[model samples]
Target: MTRALIADANLIKKVQAGEDPIGCVLCNQACLVEDVSNPIISCQLNPDAGYELEPTPKGFFQTRLKPTRLIKNSIVSIVGSGPAGMELAVSLAEAGFEVELFEKDRELGGALRRISNAGVGGVWCRSLTHYLARIENGRIKTFTDNEVLPDDIAQMAERGPLFLATGSVGSSCHSTMSGYHNWISSSDLLKSPLPAHQERVYVLDNKGDHESAWAVETAACFSDEVVLVTADPSPFSRLHKTGDLMPAISRARSLGVKFLTFTEMRAKGDSVEISKRFSPQRELVQDHMVIEVGARESSRLIEVDGNQTRQIFEIGDCFAPRTIQDAIREARCYSRALLELVAT
Candidate 1:
């Protein structure tokens, strides 16, 4: 049977390689036959060395092998269910670890969710859903809409090593001057309603990032004659490739919004002084001035001493503000380190 299977595989390969007028010869079989149009050959011969065969979908023969590995039981706990947190938990659970994932938001995704709200599609959300499904099917636990305080970390540390994926918060942009009541952070705009606009408005783009551009666009929706001034050469340069900046630029142009590049605003009364990159300094009079900047890491939970009785590791934006890819990569590395320690 083995010899016959190998022979069939070789014949198929030869046929696939453009072998024409091929003929099959079998010995010592009264029922032996061959069909030239769709050749079929049967024979009973000695199996040869260095010969292998696999079954094909059409009841023919091919060559391949299925891969397999062993899974072991272990226990692991992960904090923050952003891409990083969720990815780590899923990977550990799939590797046979009893994994538990915790998230402060009612939803599992973190910054990815917020970005989606900016009219972007949810690619990470779909991927996360698939991973969470696997974890649930494997009996892993997920805690959502729950913040992990310092005490919570200590208790979880008692069970096993605790991995922190707490994520980051918006950075502060407190202007040096007083009574610049118009200054507001991009995060604040995202969480709360935009302030009532005046006839002429000035937006100070401190971050030169995408979220800031988003704030500017939102403000342009209601404000009359919005003027955006940024220290960077272009608006939302950091997130330009993500398709965040193009729409903003296009919308501002359509709405007759004026954009000033490499410019900084010094607000005074109903006017803001502007310093351009390569021109005479001038003042732009406006009723309001809005400031949009970037974010910073919020690692308060991990900062507290004795927060964890065992070894504690920090991952994701909690360490530094970064993309989802960075978060997942860190989580994977941390999980491997934990496995190595446990083995030792």
Candidate 2:
């Protein structure tokens, strides 16, 4: 059955290149959000996701027509080599600008790397691999294992433009949980080592996104029993798309993980106490707890913006916490606008 599904030439090619052609374990935000606003079965990663026509749609085939470069030989220092920073750096480089991207981590890709390592990112890892390959051959100079401080930004701004895309940090758990000793952040669990041999795991789903779903799945892997408590009515509530949501739900069910919707959870010693929201109910207990709340913009570099240069700008999660596609699109638009400004 799996062999039959891998019969497509394109899928074969992708697999041969060590890429995931089918699994897209994204949050399905673009698909659902687009459906609400308009009615397109679009994908955040692929521009031509669901469009199938004779000659294909005009927008599907349309490519970015490179404008005449006016910003020549300008050196742009970009902080944080995440999706937003990489997209902006590549755009600026293509526009005949020298780009130097610095990442605090040893490698690029930011959160995607950690998410991929958690084995839940699906095709997101392929996107990161592609981006890394592009950066390797592109004119953009990358500096891994380098943290860009505010002073560094000021110094860079003295030469030319300085862009920040420092991504986001995990949001602190604000739940009225009594115990903090055994609690772990979602990002920390994804990046660091997982807890071994948990008897009972409780995942607090604050985001109601794929991350929460993935957290449940991850916990289920190491724990004998798992419980996901969320204020939302359903797991992956934001993921209304058929392609993304069903598989995620199926995966969770297969792992024997229980879902407690419209519930609030608090820590109580060795056990996590969960209660039904707006109901007279009994509080259930679990041995371990993981908080899968969303993150806030991490931008200490932008806090002390002593740079007087008009070119100093912040993009990506540093500007606001959003999806990877949102960050890339914003960076691309801003890069084009900057080019237009220089041209004018």
Best by TM-score: 2
Error of 2 at 78 (Å): 1.5
The residue ranges of model 1 lying beyond 4 angstroms of the native Cα positions read 1-75, 121-139, 173-182, 187-210, 217-227, 239-248, 251-258, 266-273, 282-291, 302-310
TM-score of 2: 0.73
- The whole-model lDDT of each prediction reads 0.56, 0.66
Identify the candidate with maximal lDDT: 2
lDDT per residue for candidate 1 within 73-162, as digits (tens), equals: 334567877667776786677556877888777877665555445532233344445555655666568888888888777677656556
What TM-scores do the predictions have?
A: 0.61, 0.73
